[model samples]
Target: MLSKIQNTFILIVDDTPKNIQLLGTVLKNVGYKIIVASNGIQALGILEKIKPDLILLDVMMPDLDGYETCKRIKESEKLKNIPVIFLTAKTQPEDIVKGFDLGAVDYIVKPFNSSELLARVKTHLELKFNQELLQTLLNFQRDMVLMTDGEKVIAANYSFLKFANCKNVEDFNLKYDHIMDLLEFEVKVEKNDVSKLLRLPKEEEFKVKMKRDNGEYLIFRIKQNVIPEKEVSILSLVDITQLENQKSSLEEKASIDELTKVYNRTKFQQLFKNILEENQVNPKSLCLVIFDIDHFKKINDTYGHNKGDDVLVNIASFIKSQIRMSDILCRWGGEEFTLLLVGSNIEDGVKICEKIRVQVQNHPFIQDRQVTVSMGITHYLPNDNLETFVARADNALYLAKRTGRNRTERN
Candidate 1:
């Protein structure tokens, strides 16, 4: 039993009315809607008015021949993707090749077999429909698309437009010069270089700063790849700024001194291990200094625990401001504080310790009256664990307190 086909729009562009009638009859019988154009020029005029799913063009015409007409249609951004099949009398190799060069997907000879023509058109129509569907899916999918040749954006989806805070696709009409430009982006791409598209390898991901017009910056991950047998490239963009922010918050809260707003012993222990491991691999001199407020109990007794807490907060702030960026400052419970100076050797660490001790003595932090601290500074031995490292610094701190307060001792 023969089945009826659904209506498909097909444009028949041929100068001869008889050929159009024959082609029209075959397609119309199969439930296709036919639009006729007597010549290539007429076909183009009709094209501007109506969009066809497929076109059948006779190569021979008085003017505006099939090749020229097909070229113009293929160049159009909207019409270029539509499939064009040539109707040709010339079966010569060069003629066939020329039709293909002009973007004809297939050719139908003059005095075409009805079944053969229908079968080929049916195949091409199915394929064109699938391609169009795929393109639609890519344009509207939740993930953002960043298409490029290597240097500039060819196209991007709605999600990319929303995230980029761009007025429209025109904003990114030519942004990005290289894959790395999109890498770990700290800012939006203002300029695009198209030549970089020729250089990107497959499956490489880089972090980039993506900036929007509204001064919002997001850290995005970019995945670059070339589509097989295709002229354009496809890039997938994902916003990762939230993940990085979460990581920062978690790190900050993980080992924070709750009362003093300083680094706690937990952070010190973790950082010390990592620093030591790094030093072993890259080799850097470091020193640890431990200290405690002198007569802390007496201060608590006289000024109440609230004043004692205030003293710790004030002292912690003071210690933090004095240290270099490479140094780690932490409150080590009770009245004790520890310093992990990354680049400082034993002598330099002691000099820093002495400075802190003298600063404490001269400053005389007064919640009610003067307060002072005895400090101990020591360098970590090779492969020393946290317990042993603390013991050595604690011993030095004990010595400083033994020989009066407000003094620094290093061992």
Candidate 2:
């Protein structure tokens, strides 16, 4: 159809003005934009400015001949793919063979029929368009694609070759059973029924963990479809290992404090609520301890904010080393910390708090100065909610601060 050539451009190069005009008129009448050049030199000059889809080159010309011009075109990396067809009066078999050897797609004798000229032009242009489209799709695709005849690989894209650790498809031994053996996880399809499995619903996808030849483990979501006409199966693999890792990283960051590297207040509260609910059902002794640095604001005022941060960091590290793995320690706020001790009553909580107080007083902080902490301990009550329970502990903390600092008080 003429519609295919509507937006296409063609170049006509000839020494004879009559021949150039005639060829231009034929191509122009069929909806192609035409550019004329008198000789090979002029054609090469015009090529610098405009890239035509097809070139109708004359065999004989003055100065630079058609053969040399076509040779130069083929040599150029940018212009090499444009189809060149020879239009000349020479009908010798040797001359036609020479034209083809010089990179001409087709040769038309001087007294050529209009129908023949148009058909050759249309066919070559359609072939060029399809080749370019296929290359573009292959270069831009992200998923790894492979074409297999159930027993061996027929073809594969660049992604598949890279995953297989092969420089090219020919270098890889891609046998069906051999590849299945390399995978760490099993595929749902049976060994003898790969083609039958591919004929299942197109929406079905399989998740697999594969151990690559390069000693790396990769997770892929794979889909397969059958090409009934070719008697082959097309397989697509989408890598999802990075996506899964990102999800886990996000969940950990959400529950952890950035500065202190401990559980944050939000996550601590949620965990505490869960523990409280479990304790009510099982009736186990549990205790909550709330503590804060004594004269923390005075330290910040005396020696800049940086030193204050150092003190806080050192205190948190020290406390983490002293606590059991089962205990939960959280940074409740700027200078305050809260602890949840499972299977511990008020007496047990007091012993732990006193130990922590003595350690804090003896440990050297920034500038070799001693830091002290005041603590308040309270046991869980049978009829206590989150608000009422925390309120009692907070009241005990206030009493400790009012009476004297650097000591533990129980409520």
Candidate 3:
């Protein structure tokens, strides 16, 4: 979210110290770095040296009046776009109109409100910030903005290597066509639509996927615009893989038991939603395993609570190590842990739970010297809902507890 901002500087021009001091204090507080000029001539000298982002010019002044200073500023080609606002004692509508006719963006009559002054400054600052941001995005890394000619990439920004997943920019210098046919894009890609974009030369974003050199599919938001003075289309592609991964990671964190770092009850419900959404197309076999450490409360009583926490961490780590990356593991409160295996059926899911239980029972705690686990496992039914899936797993977990501790049960 960090961005570049041009015109971060503000110049305050006034003959009176009182007015300058008041405006200078307010603008600086709101994060606009300030430059002060005591008179109109002093302001012109500073303007010649450094073109400020915005200038607050006072109408009444000795030597050159505000009108002459503003007229001189307008006459210069380089300083024309740099906005000028009038600060004046004259509240007459005609005076305000004259200030505009001389090329002022807005005017403040006499005393300015802290909120109103800040509001105007903040708005312009943000506008400049966005423009600078667009500039940065265009030429970031090898992710260059390119203007293409028909089927081939004609030219690109500094960020050229990323789109094609190439190692170096030299590979992109050559013309490339049949890119859409080669990349295996899920959605239709139209190079012709880029011509329609020429009418309005603003960035337009559309969702697209890129096939990496390693055959990995990466999500991207592609932005296209027409380049001024050049008969070409500008293309900017931003990778969104990190955003998607972060969203999944946060969702997992939200449902986890903090102390044990395992999925809590909240994660169980969310996992169901994820499975069902994907189940509409893919033949995903959903599996859940619930495990609780044996005699955990008594262990807390024998050792200090710290030791009991250590025992839980050990068990969770043991279970976590045996699982595949496609599985979800979370602390389901207290000494309990839950695993959601993405594609494992009942038999495979049961085997996974048994392996974890035996691993916990056989491995002595490096600290406590003794600890064990009992587990219950279940597979998702074709018609199973959230409560039903979990209830079946819980039943098996209870059955494991009934048939002596430190064992696994599945149905």
Candidate 4:
């Protein structure tokens, strides 16, 4: 692919026939394609049709001179990036400075050696080639990428523009003074602080959340690389929102009962442990209620297991709706369930349980038959542990069964 580098077109814009011929020959001999123009106006006209890799411009010309010609070329958005080299006899320091100020990459005197001309042409063309190659690579990436010189963004890939909903660089510049301004940092960087972003440690990686035009926020993993010699920083952002969502989904699936969509037994144990720890540190009124269907086995045997499954689901849904968000409800295997009411005493527990019990007794289940639940309530004590606390609730549940079928009992 590097062989294509030699095929780059060079536009020679000089009034003198001899100078154009000499420069064309020198460049063409080195495998470069050359186009000739007699004056600055002709060169600008040719530019409208063809974009060249480099322009050999002459300071002395008729109508529009080299300085004005160079200024117009730099002003044009399409032609500005093309390197221009001034080939002229006017070798004064001021003349050279003017060419550089007008955005000429290099200035060559008229009596310049053929070897020197070839070397300068090669250097500038190679630099432009490498820059284009880098941009192409950046555009191919799935991640958004931007290159900045600490104050403003100099280059950005197509992905970055699409992610920002920007049509082009000009549109991006209109909305943001700096690229960091668009980033909602997870931590550090003091909210749109470009200085801190530039000085971010090489080993540290942070996250930024960006809101799209569609009102959705995307999370990105941001990494910065600095080119110390040029003082340019390249920032690349990878979208990680989907991955985070998948992880959260897996964690929730692990804790939820598949049939009823309620907390499973294992999750209940874990939460109950945390509650005990917190109560030990700061005491609070807490109650444990263990309940189950009055005749779950009979329901399954009479109406089939599928209908029994429906009954369990309806009971869990009703219980979940009756409790506060702070309360915990778990399917404690089969038709049995456990509820932990945070900051609730035995009285509050009884009140909530009675409401659920009454709702279950009146609510129609599968086949429109009446359904009821028996609950055993117990409050936490200062000396209680997991086994003792759960045993008391279980024992109360046994008594509720011993005395009657559909009722709430306190232990």
Candidate 5:
């Protein structure tokens, strides 16, 4: 939430230079952006150029009076929404009524107290902010908003009525008193104690997930604002479903290798670590196999990097087809890959690796070239951590390469 005074712009339109200086100094010292205009005509010209959040207009001016200037402003389509406050020397009730009738939201006497000026400015600014915020939410068509006075619903936006399938607030109340009761909220609340939940201390914000009429799921961030003086609570449900979906899509893309479309080393490490922790309690049979293309560098040097990449992609797809859905495959590094065989013992792991090695030997990766792989197989040990376990498999791979290329070794 941004502070009310931050980024607030006020236009001071007065004939007196001393009054303008005093008001500008007071507002600027409190962190407000101020634009000064000497008379009402100049102020209206400035309004045509820059729209300020609030305006302070003097009732007496040379060419155009404050009342006429304010009238012209209220007639304009773009500038009518700006809140205008009149600075007048008159103290009669008719003068105040005339200012209000001419569209001035408030009036301040010429010799005004600084504290009262500050308070009125702050109040009107916040009121404008709230009104604009609600209008914006309605315009975007993504937020469902409603106001309640603890027990009864006072008002609701069109989006809320549409969601509830009602014509108006009265129609909505006939079916549901609390907005929380209209949907299946993910957060659990007491059955008959909704007021306690609505009156959350300090107006806490939370999230809820619900399915829409079109069978799609939507997530909303609920924000509650309580007005202690009015005893009203404004509840806003901001739609964040698209943002959450995009975040998950980004995370999925991050975990996958770009070339082979298989899980990358980082994702593989996370999955294996979780499995190792779970195995300590359940003790399931698990196997880890590390394999790499034999003479991969020579193949890349002789053919091309493009052909090498194609071979890697084809090999990954074939291996994925041969493995079970429960198994995990990841691209460990350049020309190297890992396979985690869940619920498979050492013997079954070695047999699977041998089959893959023989199949690669027979399969022609290119028109006239043969590609092969050597694998090292190892199963989980009760006392092994991730580092020690991977190191053992890597040592076995070194042994297999040392003895002969295209063979599987168990360690």
Candidate 6:
């Protein structure tokens, strides 16, 4: 139950003073503000200053006729949506047809019925108000929404313009085939079946990879619903790029040590088990190397825990730089690190461990002092489980520490 005559603005363009005065009085009495112009030139001038909801255009005006004025109004982007009703005395069929062709919504003949004129004006004003409201709602939506008739774009929301990198409606060159291009990554529907999908009453959601204007691929969750009565489909797209990135960042954080930024114990174990499973199918040389900083407690006790942390961080960085991409490095515990070398024997493991020990011994640590690591290297045996395999490497590490502080031992 919406009010019909609520602060509506109407512009009257006619050469006759009596006609302008009569129409202005009738419209103003019905709660509509009126603006009058004696000719088309004055009307266009007034239009530049004020945006009216509707225009009452007289057909036979001096110089600029109603047909020409309506044509110019429709040609304008800003004033095009205003409903124009022709005020004319011509009753010929061609004359009426000509008025409509120039974008006139309705026509009132000379000696017009006041009731008929007001009724048409009220109806068109209400229709225009509803259209403006719909456009406003569409512009306010965050998700990109579009209406299509299975082949052409009928309407698009503001978010769609932003998504497509279009500044205005004129720049938006979207077609039904463009939608199919976006769906090509995951949803494989034939062109013929597109119409069938749009006829569905239920909403369908799809994860699609859409390439943006910046040449980056972003993930979007597209939801489509069909409006059978309108013969059009509504498509809403929610950009999930940030959500997907956050999920990936969380997964990466879970698998990495916060301090050293290398794989943690849990991730190392998972990767090691995967390698072992793969090795069982096709036996390949694999080795485990365990190492710990020598006299790490003394460094922490004398130089402070801050220096101890620096020592660990520097050692992890050095080790990471020395290892191959295939090798998995992990901070096993406080002051200790582990390496899993795939496609390597005990001899290869020992050689790599020796290089690490030498580099660590030569590198300057905190307080201008030097530090070294004792390492244990072990090759995978025929029937070695996780415990036994790790224990062998641990035993060798103990042997290296027992014999001397800065050396490598194999088991």
| Best model per lDDT | 4
Error of 4 at 108 (Å): 4.8
Model 2, global lDDT: 0.82
Of 2 and 6, the candidate ahead on TM-score is 6
Q: Write the per-residue lDDT of candidate 1 for residues 115-234, one digit (tens) a residue.
A: 999999988888887765655776777777767666556666778767765544545553433434544343333344333433356426666676666767777787777764565678
Summarize candidate 2's per-residue lDDT along 105-144 as a digit string, tens digits.
9988887799899999999898789767754576467888
- Candidate achieving higher TM-score, 1 or 6: 1
The 10-residue segment of model 3 with minimum total lDDT is 175-184
lDDT of each: 0.80, 0.82, 0.74, 0.87, 0.85, 0.84
Q: Write the number of the candidate with greater TM-score, choosing between 1 and 4.
A: 4
Task: Give the per-residue lDDT of model 6 (tens digit) for 235-280.
Answer: 8788898998999999999999988888999999898888777654
Q: State each model's C-alpha RMSD to the native.
A: 5.9, 11.8, 18.0, 4.2, 14.0, 5.9
Candidate 4 similarity to native, TM-score: 0.78
- Find the number of clashing residue pairs for candidate 5: 0
Q: How many residue pairs in model 2 have overlapping backbones?
A: 0
| Candidate 3 per-residue C-alpha lDDT over 46-72 given as tens digits, one digit per residue, 9 for 90 to 100 | 988998888899999999988888999
Candidate 3: segments with Cα more than 4 A from true spot: 1-145, 150-172, 175-203, 207-221, 226-232, 236-268, 280-286, 341-348, 366-369
The segments of candidate 1 whose C-alpha lies over 4 angstroms from its true place after superposition are 1-5, 92-95, 136-141, 144-240, 280-284, 296-310, 363-371
In candidate 2, stretches whose alpha carbon ends up further than 4 angstroms from where it belongs are 1-141, 145-161, 164-235, 241-253, 273-286, 343-347, 381-385
Name the lDDT value of residue 327 in candidate 2. 81
Candidate 1, position 96, lDDT: 93
Q: Report the lDDT tens digits of candidate 4 across residue range 1-411.
A: 353746699999989898888888888887889999999999999999999999999999999999999999998989998999999899889999999999999989988799999889889988888888888999999899988776677888999999888866767888888666788887756644665566566654677898898989889898888887788888899999998789889999999999999999889999888877665423348899999999999999999999899999988998899899989999999999999888788898899989989988988886557788899999988888878888999999999999987999999
Which structure is stronger by lDDT: 2 or 4?
Answer: 4
Query: What lDDT does model 6 reach?
Result: 0.84
Which stretch of 10 consecutive residues in model 6 shows the poorest summed lDDT? 173-182
